[model samples]
Target: MTGLRVSVGDVVDFGAASGDRNPLHLDREFALRSAYGRPVAHGALATIVALGLAADREELARVVELSVDFDQPVLPGLTYRVRRSPRGVEVRLGELRVLTARWTLADRAADTAPAAPAARGAGADRPGPPPLPDGGGPRVLGLAELAGLVDESYAYRVDSAALAELLSRGAAAGVPDALTGPLAWASFHTGMRTPGRDGLLVGIRLRLTGARERPAEVWSCRAEPPLVHRRTGMVTVHAELDGAASATLTLVSLLRRQVAAPTLVETLGTLPRSNALAGRTVAVIGGGRGLGAALSCSLAGQGARVLAVSSTPATALTREASAERLPIEPLTCDARDPEALTTAFSGVALDGLVLAAAPRILSLPVAAATVPECVDHVADAARLVLAPLAAAHELLAERAFVVFVSSSAVLEPPAAWPHYAAAKAAIEGLAGHLARHRPGLRVVVARPPRMWTEMTNGPAGAAGATPVGVVAGAVVRHLLSGPAASGRPDVLGPDALSGP
Candidate 1:
C-alpha cells in the first residue's frame, strides 16, 4: 500500500499538464454545477496513481487488460492510498473506495519458450456439424461481403464531436473503454442477426490495442466478418484502425439450434464444378512442406498438371507423384531468387499459382529484432510472392487463379513472431490491391490457423490445429468454384471453409 497527499493545486497542475482541462477536475465553480458538489480529481488520475503502485510491487511485464469503475470522485486536498492485492489495484480515501481496477498480467515465460505443436491433422478427425437439408440458416452476412471484408488500405474517419467526447471520457476514466460501446453497437447491427427470438448471449470477450487515443477528422477502419462456429454459435469479429487492431470482440449466443450442422460448401450456394482443372497447369511454390505437399497431391489427383517448387530437392514429392501415377513434376527453385525462379519455369504456362513458402522463423520478440533484420526478411518474402506474378504474367492464362497461403498470425500477432505477422500483413495488402486492379486474374489468399506443420512443431502449436489435408482440400475446392470465388476474399480460413 502507498499513500499520496494531493492538494487542490496538485489536481489543477495535473489537469493542465495532462491536457485534461475538464471543469469537473480543475474548476471548483464549474464542478459545483454538476452532481458532485466539490472539485474532484480526474478518475484517470487515481488510476494512474494505482498503476504506479502496482508496478512498484512486482517486476512489471506488459499491462494486458485494465478495467476500472469510478464509484465515487476523490475530493482534492485529501490523502488517498492505493492498495494492491492479488485480484487488482484499488484507490481508497480512508476506507471509502474511490476507484477499483483489474488488470491481466502477461506471462514472462511465454516470450522465451517455444510454442507446443498441436495435434497433427486435428481438423479431419473432428466431426463437423451435421449438414443442413437446405444448406444452413440465412447467413448473417453475404459471402462476397465477408470475403472482401477487410481493406487495410481504405481510408475512414470518425466524427469530431464523437472523437472529443471519447477522449474526454478516456482522460477522465483511464481508458478509451467507452469508445468500444458505439463500435460494438455498430458491429452488431451491421454483421449480426439472431435466428430466433429466444437466443441469449452466452459469452463475450473484448481486446483493445493501444493504437491512437484521439481520432483524426477522418480515419480508415478495417473489419472482417465474425468467424462463426456453426455448432456452438460462437462468433469473432475484428476491427482495426490505422493498420492496428483497435478491438476484437468474441461472442457466443444461443442461436441456430439445428440437428444438422452447417457445412461451408452448402452455405456458399453451389458445389464446385468437378474436374474444373482437368487440363490446366498449377504450381505450388512451397511444395516440399506438409500443406503444400498435400495441395500438390490434391491438385494432381484432380487432373491438373502440377509443378512442385521448393528450396529442398523434392525427392519425396517425386516418389509420391509416381506412386499415385499423377502428372506431378518436382523442381527446385529458391523462391528468394528471381533468376532461379524465372529460369525454372521460363517456358511452362501456368493456370494457377500457390504462394506458400515461408522463411525459417526466428523466435525473438519484435523488440529484440534489428530493423535491418526485419527489412531484409520481409523483402525476401515480398520478392518471392510478387516476383512470380511479373515473371509469369505473359505465361499466365487468362483468369488464372493466384493463391497466396498466409497464416492466422496476421490476425492475432504472437509476441514472439512479430516479423512473420508484419510480412503477412504486407502480403495481404498486396493481394487485396491485385484483386481490385487485375480483373482478369483470380486471387485467393488462404490463411489457415494452427495447421500441424514443421512451422508449428513447438509448444504453442499443440491446440486447435487444423489438418493440412483439410485446408488443402478447401483451397482446391475454392479454385474450382468458378468466378464467384475470384477476388471474393483477400483471405479465407477454416472459419470460412468446410471440409470436402
Candidate 2:
C-alpha cells in the first residue's frame, strides 16, 4: 500500500487539467440537474492516484497507460488507498470491495519532457515534447504489440440507456477477502456471487490477441449479471486497457493473482454451444499413467465424462496423476485382473473406451536380466482393459466407441527386443476381433510411431517422441470420424510417419 492522497481540489484540478470539462463537475448549476444531484469526480481521477502510487513504488515512474473500473461514485473528500503493483498501482477503497483501478507505467521519457517555464502566460508558446522516437520515440506501435492494447468493444443490446452509461463509465464489484472460498456478494445484486471451486484457479489469462501486459487499473469494469446454466454459474467480465503491450501483460498478471478458486468463475457467458459429443461417456481403461493420462485429459476437455481406470489401487504413475485436477475421475483396477476391472467400471455407463495403459513390453538383450518383467509391462496393460469390456457388455451405453492405442514398434522391432513386438501384435488382434464382431459399437485403433507420451518419453522426457498433444489430436480425429471409409483396421506405422 503506497500512501498517496488526493484532496478534493486535487481531484478537481486533475480533471480540469486533463481537459475533461463535463458539466457535472465544472458547473454547480449543471450538476443540480444531474441524478446524483451534485458534481462527482471522474473515475479516471482515482486511476491517476493509483498510478502515482505505482510510480512511487516501481522503477517506471511515467505511466504509459492506465485502466480503471469504477465502483460506486466517490463523493468529494472520501479517501482511497493506493494499491501498488510491479507494473503500476490501483486506487482501492474498503476491502477488496469493487475493483477500483488499473494502471501501467513505462519509460516515456523520450515522449514527454519538462517545459522551460514560459515567460508569462505563453503556455501555448511551449512546444509539445521533442519529435519522433525512432529518430525520437517509436513511430509505429508494433503490430504484435499494438494488438495487446485494443480495448475489446462490448455489445449489450438489452438496454439502450444502460449501454450508453457503460460505454461512458465502467463499473466493478468488490471481491471478497477469500476468492477461493465461495461467492462475493454486493448490495447491487442482492447477495450475488460466484461459486468457488475446490481446486486453485492457477492463473488468469486474458483471452486477448497477441502480447500485452495486464494493466493494474482497468477503466469501466461492470458488475455483470450472472449467467447460470445446469446449476453452474458464470460471470462475464469486460475490462479496458491503457496501452497495448506491457499494460495488457501486467494487468492480466495481476488479475491472475487476484483470481483463485473461490472468486474465479467460468467467465464465458451464454455464447453459442454445440452438442458435439452429446450423450457420450468416454471410458479410458488404462488411464493410470503415461499415454493413458494423455487420452483422459484430452477426451475430458472435449466435454466427455471420462471414466479413468488403472490396474492398481495405486501405481507410482497413478498416484502422481491423482493429484492433478482433470476432467476425468481416476479409479483403480488392475488391467490384468478381469473381475477387479469389471467392478471398477460397473457404475459407469460408457460411450467410448480408450486403451492407453500398455504394460512395459520393452525387449532387452537376450542376456539381460529379467526379460519377463519387460513383457508384462506392455503386454499385460493391453489385456487388462480388453478382457473386461469383452465380458460386461452392459457397461457401454449401446453404440459406443472403442479406441485401442498401438505402437509402431511391431513393424520395426528394435534388435535388442522382440517381446514388446509380440504384445503389441496381440493388442492389435484384440481390437480387430472386436471391430469385426461388434457392428453396433465403432472400434477405432491408432498406432502412433512414437508419441511424447510416457509410452516413448519417460517422466523426464529423455526419449524423443512425437508431441503427445499432436498424437492425441490425431486420435481424437479418429474417434470423431469413426471407422475408415475403406472399413479396414486403422494401422499407423513407422513408414506412414513423415517427420522424426
Candidate 3:
C-alpha cells in the first residue's frame, strides 16, 4: 500500500495511550544498561506501522490475523519503512530486522454509484506535520489535494530493504520529522493528548521498496482517516536481528492496540490492592502443565494463593510456584474420580477454581484396527482414565470454574488421527454440557492446539503441537477473566504453546 510509514514519537504515544509503560519505552536509565545499550522500541509500534501500510490498501481496522514479531528492537535515529501487499506488511530498517504481519480487506459497503471507502492504496500522501496552524485558525492544506488511494496500481507488494533505504533518504531530507516517526500511544485519557481537536494524527514518511514484496491478500482492511501515525526523523537504525540469529520468537500482545481504561488500570482513587486477588484462595486443576501451569504462574505472580494440580505431578511445573514463594499446592489426582479430587482440595475455602488440564493424550496410530493395540490405546485410556477424571470434577468448590482442556482439533482433523479427534470431540461435547447445565460451578472450557512441550516436539515431536509456555499463558488469561469476562473458549495454535 502507498503512503505507509510511521514515527517513533507516535509509537511511544501509542504505547503510552495503551498504558504499556514498560521500562524499555519509558526508562532511559534501564534501557541504557540493557542489551541493546539504549532504549529499544516497542514491537507494537510496528503493528501500528503495519496498519498504516494497510491504509494504502484498505482501512486496517477491518483486518485481523494481524500477527507479527520483533526481529530486533528499533532504536533512536534509525530510518525505517513500511511496505505492504495483499498478503502482508513489513516494518523494516534497511537491511536490518523487520517485523512482518498479514492483513486483508473486508467490510467496505459499496453502493450503486461509487463507494465512500477507497480500497486501493492511491490517495493524497499526507506530508510532514504542518507548522502550528496559523493563529490557531482552521488549518488549511498548502498544496492541492493529491490523488489519494484511488485504484489498484498503488496496491503493490513492497521490498522491505529498499523501502527502508528510501526512508533514510527522506529522513535526511527532513520530509518527515522525528515527531512523526514510529511511535505508539499510551494515554491515560482519550483526550490527554488531543490531536488538533479531531485527533489529527501526523503521518511519517520513511521509504519503501514498493511492489513485488506485498502479500497475496490483506484480509478485512479498508481506508479511512489516517490519524494514528506521527513522524520520527530517520536516524541510523543500529539494531539488527543479530544476522546470525535464526528461529526468532513471535510476540502476541493485547498491549499493541488501544484498550479500555479500566482494563489497563483501576479507576483513580481506587487503591490498587482493593482489586488485587490478594488473600484469595483459588483452586487450579491441570495447574501443572501447559495452560494450567501458565495460569498458575500469572496468578501466583499476582500474589494469589494458588492451589495448582495436574494429572501427574511434574517437578518442573511445581517448582515454578515455590520459586515465586507463592502459596501453591500442586497435587496429583484423577479429577474424574471424585474422592481423590475432593480430598486433595479439601482445606481451601475457594473463591475461584480453574480447571485447565487434559489427561494423558498420546497420539498413536489408534486407527490401526489391524493392531488392536492402536485402537485400544485411546479407548482403553479414556474409559479407565479421562472419563473418570472428568467425573471427579464434581467435588470442586462453589463458584469454582472447572476449565476443561478442550481441543480445536474437533473443528478439523487430518486422515491419520481419527481416534484422537473423536475423543477430543466427545470431551468438547461434555464440556459444553457442563457449561450449559452446571451454571453455578462456573464450568469454563479452554481449547488450545498442540503446544510446545517436551512431549510434543523435535525429532521425537508429533505432527500438531505448539509451545507449552504459550498455551499456558492463553489458559491463564481465560481463567483469570471471570464470568463477566468474555466466555468464549480460548483457542491457541502451536505458537500459543511455545512462545507467542
* TM-score of each predicted structure versus truth: 0.45, 0.40, 0.38
How do the residues 1-500 of candidate 1 rate in per-residue lDDT, one tens digit apiece?
77644557656644433333445465665343233435666555555555555553232223345556555556565556778878577776544566776766555412322111122243433322222222333234433333344422334322323322333332322222223232322222221232212122333334544434333233344545546554444434454443122544343333322111112222122233245578999888888656777778777767889888887777766877776686888888877776777888878889988888776454334432134556766877788788766666677777788888888888888765667798888888888877777767888888886765554432223346666766777777767753553455446865754364
**What lDDT would each prediction earn against the true structure?**
0.55, 0.42, 0.40
lDDT assessment of candidate 3: 0.40
The residue-level lDDT of candidate 1 at 240 comes to 49
1-500 per-residue lDDT for model 2 (tens digits): 64433355644553323323344444555443233335555444444334334443222223343344544344454444566555445554434232344434334432322111112233433222222111221122222222233333321111112211222232211111111000101110111111111111111212222222321111212223222222111222233222222212112110001111100011111111123565578877766545565566556555676667764442443443344433457677666676776677667687777877655432243422324544554556566656766644577655777777777776777754466676677888887777677666666667776654333322222235555544554566446654542334566544333122
User: What is the per-residue lDDT of model 3 for residues 1-500, given as tens digits with 9 covering 90 to 100?
Assistant: 23334455644543433333445455665343233334445554445545544443234323322344445455444445667656666655443435666643335511211111112344533223221212232222211111121211112111222223333333311111111121222111111112111111112222111112122211111122212222221111111011111111111111111111111011111112122567777767666654566666666655568777665664765565555465667777765565676677666567666655443333233222213433553454344334434444554455555555656666677443455576666666665666555565555555666544432322223334444444554454544554442333334343333443
TM-score of 3: 0.38
Error of 2 at 394 (Å): 3.3
What is the lDDT, from 0 to 100, of the residue 288 in candidate 1?
A: 66
Query: Top lDDT: which candidate number?
Result: 1
lDDT of 1 at 223: 47
Model 2, residue 387: distance off in Å is 3.1
Residue ranges of candidate 3 with Cα displaced over 4 Å:
1-275, 311-313, 334-336, 359-398, 458-466, 482-500
RMSD (CA, angstroms), candidate 1: 23.7
